[model samples]
Target: MKVKSLFVLTAMIGAIAFHQTALAKERETGRSTGPVVYVIAQDKFYDSIVLADLPAKGRFQQLFPGEGPSGLATEYGPGDVGYLGGRWWVDGNENGEMDEEDAYFLCPLLGPGRDDI
Candidate 1:
């Protein structure tokens, strides 16, 4: 029984690792082409995490300096929390490093949010 349990656990872990590897490759290249691409929005509406089926048009945010392809930090909550699948970058002032001036954005906030649009 113990050996069988260990085998099942190992198989589960291997499957998860393979899924993550495929996802990382997809992120590096382009968005996932699967039929159902789910997206999680960090903003909480009425004390609930929002989840939606990712739209086809305007999916990822364009990365500066042309790093192939990239996306915005969508998992950031109201208080700026971090997560594994969230996007983090440093591309201000056209430099490759995050400095004091490059940390802030020109406008306080960007365009309309997902809920708004």
Candidate 2:
């Protein structure tokens, strides 16, 4: 009975040590940090975008809204911060595209409307 208990304790300690080592390696290899942004649009065709690094201590919240539309082609002007990804929140089917009369809230992910993030 004593031997079995000793073996089980040893195994448990080994497992914990292995887990810590793996986590340390992941941090040291620079495999962790990434940018974070949030965007929200309402049903009234108004959309807002926010972009920046993850909030940290001593950091202040910032809001950057785009200027109102200027031409006949563009209707929605940029508003508030920037977004990291464009999420077209529509009230229709899941076609991943915009439709007529469908309320949309698009958060541009990578600065403005770009093809790649």
Candidate 3:
């Protein structure tokens, strides 16, 4: 029984060491283990533009530069918030209006020099 227990413990330790070595080799080979996310945006002419292409695990800010209300941070509740008018929605089904298939979209709050159309 003692010899059996020792063999099992040795096997477990070897398995763990092998897994760690494999992970280190993968990292040294420059292999990414996370998904890549592409952030798309629309220009004034309604043209689709690739704003950012980064890893999904990377930190990202929702609001773009020069956006949001004055004297306030980029974070804000969506929809009509006092002076800031208009609402944001993701047309998931490619429809013009929000529906069951659509979702609430978090975008930069419009401020001075910004237009919501």
The TM-score leader among the candidates is: 3
The C-alpha RMSD of each candidate to the native structure, in angstroms, is: 18.1, 20.6, 20.8
Candidate 2: C-alpha lDDT: 0.28
lDDT of 3 by residue, 1-117 (tens): 334333433443344344422111233335322111111231111101122222223223332222222211223322323312212332334555434443332223222221221
- lDDT value for candidate 3? 0.27
Error of 1 at 57 (Å): 37
By lDDT, the best candidate is 2
Please state the error at residue 31 of candidate 3 in Å: 33
Candidate 2, which ten residues in sequence have the lowest lDDT sum? 64-73
Worst 10 residues of 3 by lDDT: 42-51
> Total backbone clashes of model 2?
10
Per-prediction TM-score: 0.20, 0.18, 0.22
Candidate order, TM-score descending: 3, 1, 2
Whichever of 1 and 2 has more TM-score, that candidate is 1
Clashing pairs in 2: 50-82, 51-82, 64-80, 64-81, 65-79, 65-80, 66-78, 66-79, 84-109, 85-109
- Per-residue lDDT over 25-94 for candidate 2, one digit per residue giving the tens place of the 0 to 100 score: 2333243222212222311122223232221223122222221121001222245443223433222233
Cα lDDT for residue 59, candidate 3: 29
Q: Which lDDT tens digits does candidate 1 get at residues 1-117?
A: 334333433443344344432122333324332211112353321111112222212222212222211112233433333322212222344565543322221111221222311
